[model samples]
Target: MWTTGKVIERIDWNEKLFSLRIKTDVEPFIAGQFIKLSQMRDDKRVARAYSLVNPPGCDYVEVLAVAVEDGQLSPDLKALNPGDSIEVTPKAAGFMTLDEVPKGALQGKHLWFFATGTAVGPFISMLATDEPWQRFEKVVLVYGVRLGEDLAYLDTIKQFIEQHPQQFVFIPIVTREDYPEGLSCRIPDGISSGLIEQKAGLGINAEHSQVMICGNPGMITDAQTALVEKGLVKNLRRAPGQITVEKYW
Candidate 1:
């Protein structure tokens, strides 16, 4: 059912990217789950699923989104200011949480998160919690965007690095322009070329890596193909494997 949500805060990352922190009655949810935001438009309901960026125990829900050109709802969302009301799902939903990863023997030592664009939101939510730090020896985040200006949440990421210097790695990839702190290739190309692993100083294989990829469909497909070539398999509930993915679009 739909619940009324008030926009309590907003953060403009760039002209196109922004974050909305909403106060609502949405039930507690897992870190990586998503909630649908909706509005009534000309007698029709326009809704979109956005992954919750805030960690699970928060009193509010936060989502990172980009205003897609000519999108049905995002442009309107972009125009919203604090105190504006929107409709939200009362309960968040999705199966991309860390709980899905296998435990004990199959649970690898390194947890890798691959994200592009606003898909990094869910990963950020997961990282804010203690589960990953307690469970894995190493955690890595590979975030890719179109340009340097498109990267978001740098300060939060920096905090993670400071808190876990030896155990965390962040690889930024900017494809269209120079990003001295990151790579110039697309995510799949980086993996295929070994540049990503070279930066992490750790190789991905079936035994030691648990990878969760969330991003544009094209990136997810190509990245998964590259990982599969490296012996990692798709993670499924029935048959646990190494790679897990959520396509943002």
Candidate 2:
């Protein structure tokens, strides 16, 4: 079912990237899930799934999105201003949350998040919760984008660092341009080349690392392959393993 949501706030990170905070009633959701936004055109419904950026229990829901060229619904979403009304899913859905990660002895010492473009939204939601901090010894977020300007939620990330300076690590990756603080290669390459682990000052293995990957499918595929080479396996409900993934597009 759909619910009417009013845009309460909007943040434009760049020409193509933006965030919408909407006021609406949605079923309680866990972090790392997504909700669908919709619009009707010529009696046809146009809808897309957007990962929630805000954590659970918030009065309003937030979503980070990019205006894809010639996209069916994203452009319309990009044009929305505060007070604009939109359609939202009453229930959020997805299985990429930390809940899917193994618990007890299987839970690794370090939690790594690999995201690209707007896919970083879900990871941000997960980080906002207390589960990651309380469950692992180290939490690292590796965010990749075309340019430094595309890196959204830096302020919130900074706050996380301030609060857990010793436990949190943020790594930025800018592929198309120069970013002094980030790597200039794709995520898979970084992993295969050992640059990612080197920068984290921690190696990834089956025993010590649990990786959650989101964003571009290309990155997900290749990054998963690299992790597998390092002895990590795909996480499943019946047979839990180290790596969990969700493809954004």
Candidate 1 to truth, TM: 0.99
lDDT of 2 by residue, 1-249 (tens): 999999999999999999999999999999999999999989999999999999999999999999988999999999999999999999999998988999999998999999999999999999999999999999999999999999999999999999999999999999999999989989999999999999989999999999999998899999999999999999999999999999997
Q: For each candidate, what is the lDDT?
A: 0.95, 0.96
What are the models' TM-scores?
Answer: 0.99, 0.99
What does the lDDT read for residue 220 in candidate 2? 97
What's the residue-level lDDT of 108 in candidate 2? 82
Q: What stretches of model 2 exceed 4 Å from their correct place? A: none
lDDT of 1 by residue, 76-106 (tens): 9999999999999999999889999988999
What is the clash count of model 2? 0
